[model samples]
Target: MTVVGFRSSIGTWGCAIGLIGLTLCWPAITPVSPAVALADEPAAAETPPDQPENDGSTETDSQETPSTGRTLEDAPTLERQVLTELESAPHWPARALAAIRLERFDCAPTRDRLIEFVQHDPDWRVRANAIRSLAERSIEQGEGWFEEEAEPRVIRTALRYGYEVDAGRVHRGVRFLLRSNRLDERLLGAEIAAASGKDDLVADATDTVRSVILRMDRAQAGLLSPRLSAMTGVRGLFSRQDWMRWFRENGRRVELAETRRDPPNPHPPPAGERSFLAELNVDAFARFESYVQQWPELRIDLVFALDCTGSMTPVFSRTQSIISDTMLFLQDITESPRFGLVAFRDVDQEFVTRPFRLTQDAEEIMLQTWLQEAVHGGRQSESVLAALHDSYAMSWREHVERLVILIGDGPPHRGEGGACIRLAERARTRGGIRTQVVEPINAPVRDFKEIAEAGGGRLWTLDDYVLILAELLGLERSDDIDQAFMAFIRHYTELLR
Candidate 1:
């Protein structure tokens, strides 16, 4: 809860590169002090093969001793003093050793000293360095203090020190600027400003000021990342305000309108729709999950082929649970597949979810939060097939098994749906992908059945749609999953054998 930091020895820009700034406060009794930097691209570095990569994986060497140990436990001296500097450690490119070292030693006094420097230090770079220190230390609890902002520590540090490169901070500040109508006020103390009086952004984003302003306007106009907003139901694509408030006032109203608008289907399914649930047990799904779990020599991946044509409006309404639910299913699975979602319509396409290598649990909560606040979509060609092809072609990571999950009303617009099935078949034949189709019954299944068969994937009707989704993504099957999974697994086993 303590928001603290100190400048590092490196200069301001150095803080941006190696990102070594804050030395957050901890309980250790003693203290020391520091100062600012920038430098060449972080020097290519190496650590013991067991050590972490430059990208911070070193924080996870699995060698990290959990802090559950009692406070009295002995602490290891930081192997070396000069090398202890993370932002400027010259020899090793400052591996996780530096960050890990900070974790063990009580840096509270150092953190306090950093805070003091930021508040009083004349050099904006020095203040920037102070925040860098805090950013490095924010993960003390593993669960980030990152509220909706994701990095209050770093943003405050960036604001204090005058660097603005992080996409998050840039967007956050833009949102604030829009809401406050006080761009100049927020720009006060804006150290990173250029002669144009606009804040100097990160090198990667040097040209986005005008663009960002436009984005802000679009967000205000409710037109940013319709795909993301639709999937997450998170209004204000980039609208900046106390979102929780926006969520309460506007979110509640939208939700109420939605509920009222979509009266319950007069034809709810009978309670006894599915009685003998043979697929509920793992015996039925051993090969499916086990194969997926052990698929990769090292990793596996998942992709969601979401639909977003105008016809899908009602589907989105009833299917707000799709994204959140699928994400949770990924969490329940033993194999943590890198996940991404691709929502497509011909004229307009939204990657809304990009493919990334990460465990399902890591993404599930955020995906759920995203879905709860996301918006519905726009109109376009029912291009499920084209979206899959392009997404696969564009993906760079080599995954073990590419699971393309198609979430749409069964089939596509007339003469347009076969591309998806063909793409799935191609992925399976050459790339070892395991394709599955979670099609809805809202549209005709006439074309969907052929599509599913062609792709060698399973097809399910949207009865207890959410439950079907659960099993397809390996979630806990409620009812439909039990029925549908059995059929799918059996077919897969028969075909593979």
Candidate 2:
């Protein structure tokens, strides 16, 4: 598939290659411009020959920078070179690449430059990259960016990175995207609503989805129906009147369901107490049951590969609960769904990878115990490749659907020779194991996305995982899954490719 187009001529692949080349050539490049050196040469004439050239920023001034203590002049040579590219690169792709590279550096100048690109870059791709860089640094511009940004791609980038959303901005952005003539943009609007997890916008988002489905042809509507199902949390409602009637009767219940699961709810009930499917009114529940009854009984084997490292400590409990809830929900829907788990940390840890074979034990006592016993003290980068490789050793069922959901926050350590990606490819080709990633918004996502793509699955954020899973598992036929995948690729081309 082609990369999504920005307002520039250069394709994404070309930009990626150019950026890689620039990184490789960084060390040999001159750090300072000759003009700046010439201007400072007279003042520094009295300095020792071995002394570094001073850029005139005081030490006190450096202390006040955002995250890093060094000014651009004192920053490492590689960072300085990337900063120069960001400032003076002629092409939009070069600037975009520079913005992405700058994410690793957290100094005042880098922050200022990224903010400038977010505000004034001519190309949307550059702005999107800059937005992601800022988000990675934990620098949030709040709802103001959402209110001011005109491009859906830019807004979606912010949304995907955990930017705080309020009622006012969501209402405005949802209305703008939903009202667009382009089907992709409209679908993105529904996506934005779903990602936002704002119960208040449910009515408007549901109404818009219903209206769009009614107007589009069957094929196009087939692509959009999942969004409606995701938003309303009820499947099998086809006609506009059916959706309207359901919403009128149970709209408040949908909002309440969202409230229960939304991340902001500090006191979320335990996994056993919450069930989105069970909470639906009797009629909606009956409809969903009827919808699933047509499908032939199928056997499925699932595995969860979780990263138990220091970085994941903050959200570990919540993540575990979500996975537990997911298992319960899947059990409710499917006839036979067996689950396994592989908890992993870095090589330096006591254990690199701990595996639990697939089992039909619905009690899930062993899985839950392992999940709770999983320790979290490794380095930032975990043994993801080891976990993936070990997952293949599981006794997967033959001629049945197999899935592996990798939940993590960091990439694999260096010098793994891309073994993790190769495992993903082999899983799809020989083992029939589809891989999906559930990643935190602030985590480095490119590698996880690659694994998912190789294993023929989609990468989902924690906030959107439930909805995406609902859509993915609810599909009755292969063609419907293909259409859903196409819609996903269309909306997320910038991130996926």
Candidate 3:
């Protein structure tokens, strides 16, 4: 088995090709004067370097002036350059730059181009940037675009725009969005309501959010709960009852003091490194009849298709810890586990699918190191179908149980729904490969249930990952086998620290 060591720098650079900054920001729209564009000089002062955020602040006396002194004396020339870049940029990165620059103009042509970008930009980042651009122009114009836009990024950008520019507009738009049956839209509305501190919006949408959470299965809960907590600033509210109690007790008092330019982190920083014994906090008392009965462990060929997107960075770290630290345990199972890993993110982010072939390497040192160096993903929605298809293509040993554990936070790209289920169905019936899903915290479990069911596998939550895997592998908590495993984890954590 040739396990090559390789890495790609897809999302780490900011000079021109990759993401401008690790922090998410609205790229400012600066109009370059014809004099500046034509002359041997730098661009205008309005053109700030592509920083992730812009805090609506002007340069004070202490701030330095632009090296180039070309002023916006002629609107027509600046407008022409913006239009030219929007239409003629050779690459998507260049196109994204133009889209960001397009945010400054208020003319009809500018508005039309933004709309076009929102509708047709193949790159979601560019489209999202366009949405922000359109929103910054005017709330009325943004609301108009919202009527025609359905992408989650566009809707999210519009909501933030309303929160940034006009609260009443946010309330109206959220009200309309919450009325929809679309889960993503409703969730966006709920988050905005919680963030905006609009009592009326909260009163109207809390019930809906609660209902959705209540209807979700365990895997779905694991993924959606953390997001709700972050958006509402409610901690540890994982159950439906918890949400109801919070609303009844403090919903009215929930007044957002100001628009949060940066939303709080979903995965809060840990308090401190726990004692090695803490790693053995397995749910021994909890029963695992469903997982054990439906999908017992066997000699298996496994593929872990993971979401390596930006939002998943926290979970990704945890995942790396679990996989790398438990290599000995994974190898010691009655049916030795041969693992193939696929690290995936959305299109236009970094590399889409970085695959590692099936191996039972005792250390998995290379995989561990590669995980450390993986670039952060750019967008939220990932290429689920692509990852699953790649997983299904891996070579499997004869007479072994074949499994693919697909994990991620958000749903698949638009128009690619049910594609995974279809593939899983075929793989199960014809190829004997069962596809499971380990929905990471805050991941939406929309079609993952269907995918698991189609492959005759149980859908799992990241919260129950350890317990379920232990049970499947016939490893008991606190047993010699388990202790040895925890010891390895302890050593791994200490070394990393």
Candidate 4:
């Protein structure tokens, strides 16, 4: 197994390319930048090199973007460069590659480097890599780092890695992060709790998890004035302890416990209450004045595959309204998000808009007006199967979820919609893609199963469009959304019951 040893001045140097060798198979990571050679040069990210986050600041003062003139080779070339560079140096970037490689390899040096990075690395993402690297090694050693319990990202990374590489650790980590006030940390905790297959781990938080949460709570409160509401985000991160205990007492399956809906409040429903799902993701977005306020996860990409066909005229009209609302919603969110649009016709799908921030009122207005101009002229000869099968070519990205909401009501003109569904399935399973299909009632049920199964997505009938759209946006905390996610999990696990 290939593993990282340490960082040196000459970029990332590698000893063995044991497991990192597998990355060579991916065929895309070619043309890595030449080694900077010095101990100090601007790192590839926007922030300055190796600065710890403190005082509620996530970034450093420097905005040193990696030199962009360097053109990337195709996937295979990318893989060759990554493999060659990682094997040659133990610099930060090399260490990063080694960490990922160690996920497939393992050794004492790699483990130690990971531990050191987790404890001392200034970059959160680098630390994130260290946690992931350790978890991968834990696959064999079975004894991962118990010392990183205090860090939220470490805890979250542990939970994810644990579920895949070690169930017990994942179980423990989930509870630890759930009791964290940091929403990102807590949400990650929820994902871990939901993912753990072990009945005990899923059913009960370990003493370690409890201790971690308590310590984190204390840490957040300055280790002096322990407060109550401050604990709720962390506390509710996992379901109430009583709920878990009850699930254990009832001998419920871990899967069932996970899929079960949150309990209805004892308090009466407020009069004239409206379902968040009914509002539509495009519409509810209007509520957030800022990207951070609009969603718990900060990064968002809105991609619309609009149908340009005679039958889809009305559906396209609704698309127009959603587009307007989305533009307004963008204004509230952070400047980081990107919005893009595509028009699908009978023969092919094309990009009519580029990713731009809603922060620019002029840009948003132009975007909406552009959406109007393109909606009509695009021909409808393209097949839904063809449009999506080729989507990865246009919109794929790393570290962020890609949401492709297709508005249409028929089979693809090229390959069967079944092909597109299979492709979608692969993307979401890898956590790099998501697809939501909207179609008219009489379109076709045969393809619905394919899209839903492969894409790890939901297929909505236009008649029930409101319900499905809400679920897509994750707006309602209800049964439909619950089942929709159950479908989501089914994509991840084969033993669907």
Candidate 5:
């Protein structure tokens, strides 16, 4: 389909603060000339409430519009302007807005650029918008183009994006995606089931997807809250168990021959609310805190975000040693303390991020196994943003103080004005995941400091970070672990000095 006319306007878009940027892009089509419209000109069409932009605030205010007074007026110009912004825009909001606006532009290059964004953009918002935009455009343009031009990966990405855009057209896609054993794909299916707002459809989800829904963290719980909340008149439900029970009891309602005609609820619960999930979480956490204060011990959910890049090779063995010892210490001192790990390297590497589920492995063997087996080889910068995003997603037990200790030697890609900092803020404000950065004596410290502060965590040298964690957990430093930590502190201090 060739577009004869279109208009671009800087409009307000929803920027999700903490969760991987998930924004809805709906471009308003207005007939206009092939000339670029200046910012001062009034927009012909009203902007959709879900326009994607990066403002770093967790609040989803519909009234928030882009500061760019300009709008797109033609396909050729839109393609040029959007592509230019995606390539060179200094700020994420510009890139994201470019991506959201790209949806309405119809051209072969636009399609290709959207696919590129899906594959390569470091920022998740750009990639998501590109996927959603491509899916919407393909649906509108007809099957001929997709049948002839779309690749398998593109089709799969489109199917997932279709769930967010138009679920009605992607039933077969959802079913196909559900059959995949990959956790990410299954997650796509589960999200589709929840987004569909049809309980029978959700109930029919494969066991894998069902299990995922049953295992969702509070953030994931928030995703399924809209229809569930509206259905039960219960606004504050959290945890996979509560949702599973509700689904099992109400699954039959969605199976009726008559389709439910409930108006879509605009406000799906936000994950960052002070009363996240249930009132029970608040009460339980309050009691847990009181109990902890009385007991004089720390109950923490600790995750290690280790940098496993080529530059970090020198410390790989030592890092593993540190993790093994720390886990053992936690097991002995804290009451069933949970431990998790995220090992990361830069983009275009063997892997960007490798995440392990939270566990209390008393043996402390498997944690060591992963630490030893994972190789780090790539560019100097790494996927710190990806690691932070995964850290936010971990299912920390309720009432446990969530802490992520990021141990890395390289700066995060897109460190300046990137989504990583905002995401860190999101993790702190929404998920209550405090982060601490442990920079290698040789690694860049400025980025680590900024990101750690943004996430409400601290930045320290490797040795100091280890000691701080130990002290907080009330672990005695009189042991071999403490000696090893102290030795490193002296070595780094002397070496750096």
Candidate 6:
């Protein structure tokens, strides 16, 4: 079999380069490139409504016909070719790419085809891409479509896109995700519900909501409490029992105040009203102090599986610093912290993977030595799957918070048919190891997202390591940390604009 490498501008992230029939290389973040000519099809008499308006200048045109030696007259022909590919492309990747390309077209036919893909596409990747494109264009497919979608990834895409086409659909989707067994999905549901400020979104699922609250650790509960309080019109409650009791007692009668103005004073101040605020403040302070006292007893085991291939040379030093800083931070919060390392390269490299078993803080020096000794030399695709398998087999502490952070810049060798995702699922189900994937800049995200979802963790960028570490460790509550995280997100949003 002959392998060919070709780059095609798929979506907003950047171009995807196909290598060895499986690998996809995501270039660094940049503006969406002009559409490439896929095929030589007959021109249509009238231009589609979604087609970009053609101007004389090459810079302003959205099509790459001029560079390809084709004329601007072939713009409609190119649209037909892309639409045809979306409908009948034999390979799933081609179909997925076509769906991404259709984002530039917002006509009825483009929307109808994308909606069909969302409803009936055999591949989940294709369906996810289609739904994302629709959401990006802000074209709603009405109700009952996204609400009934069963795949967690597709539902997550809708949630990330804030697909509020219909309130009922969004409510149903949130309910479904809240009930999901995956921790990441449930967390996302809680975040969306709290952010949406829709008090009735989880009205009937009080028990499920309480369970989610009960599962959260101290830091998580602290960060989420104020927002949830604002949404539920309740304050100073921490435990699940307190929340449920309040819901049962005053949930239906209490309505969120419509105005910010102070309520009218009672003719005669109620008894104990003078001390109520003081008492609540004292109770909240006591609860936080108790959590702080228990922090030292928490146990955690973390393994870092890094792709030590030549391509990662540019960002490898930064990766090392992130890992080191995380370890130092963990030591401050927990008395018992175990660390491990797995450095991986390609099959033909000096070594495919060098793994260091989970060791206590006393042996941190050895782990750092192994990490620094890794040499970067290999093909584009490294032995990522092999490294994950090794990391899962490490001597993880039983009953501790087990975590694996996989940092890489490309896909696994030959893709391995999603073997890494399967391994992550097995580790989560049998070993309770939550796997997080950290991509540097423009790494391909589809495979990493799937693996993280399977392992009940979220995919994060390299810049988010501090926040990720803080969340996983349930570190001390600090307003600065929260503000920094939100600011980073806003920065990314501005870049998208």
Question: Which candidate wins on lDDT?
Answer: 2
- Candidate 1 lowest-lDDT run of ten: 255-264
Per-residue error for 394 in candidate 1, Å, reads 6.0
TM-score of each: 0.35, 0.38, 0.37, 0.33, 0.36, 0.39
| Model 1 lDDT per residue over 160-212, tens place | 32233444434434333223222221221121222112333332122322232
What is each predicted model's overall lDDT from 0 to 1? 0.37, 0.55, 0.51, 0.40, 0.49, 0.54
Supply candidate 1's per-residue lDDT for 283.
47
Clashes of each: 30, 0, 4, 34, 8, 0
Q: Model 5, poorest ten-residue lDDT window?
A: 30-39
Per residue, candidate 2 scores C-alpha lDDT tens digits across 1-497 of 11121111211212322211110111111110000000001122355698885443323233333543324556556555445644575555446545654555546776677777876787665787777666655564532344335455455556666665445555665665566564545656665665565665555555566565545542233223444554556766533344456657864334311311212212222222322321233343333333333223546788888888777766665566456545644553355778888888877777888887788663342234223433556454678899898777799978767888898888877755277888899989988888888886456554788888898887888776655454545543344333333332232233311
Cα lDDT of model 3 by residue, 222-241, tens digit: 33444555555566554444
Superposition TM-score, candidate 5 onto the true structure: 0.36
Candidate 2, superposed: residue stretches over 4 Å from native: 1-291, 294-296, 365-378, 471-497
Candidate RMSDs in Å, in order, are 18.9, 23.3, 22.7, 22.4, 23.3, 23.9
lDDT of model 5 at residue 285? 26
- Stretches of model 6 off by over 4 angstroms after superposition: 1-291, 362-378, 415-417, 475-481, 484-497
Local accuracy of candidate 5 as per-residue lDDT tens digits, 339-375: 7877777677778787877876533333232334335
Instruction: Tell me the deviation in Å of residue 188 in model 4.
Output: 42
Task: Please give the lDDT score for candidate 3.
Answer: 0.51
- Could you tell me which 10 consecutive residues in candidate 4 have the lowest summed lDDT? 21-30
**Regarding lDDT, does 2 or 5 come out ahead?**
2
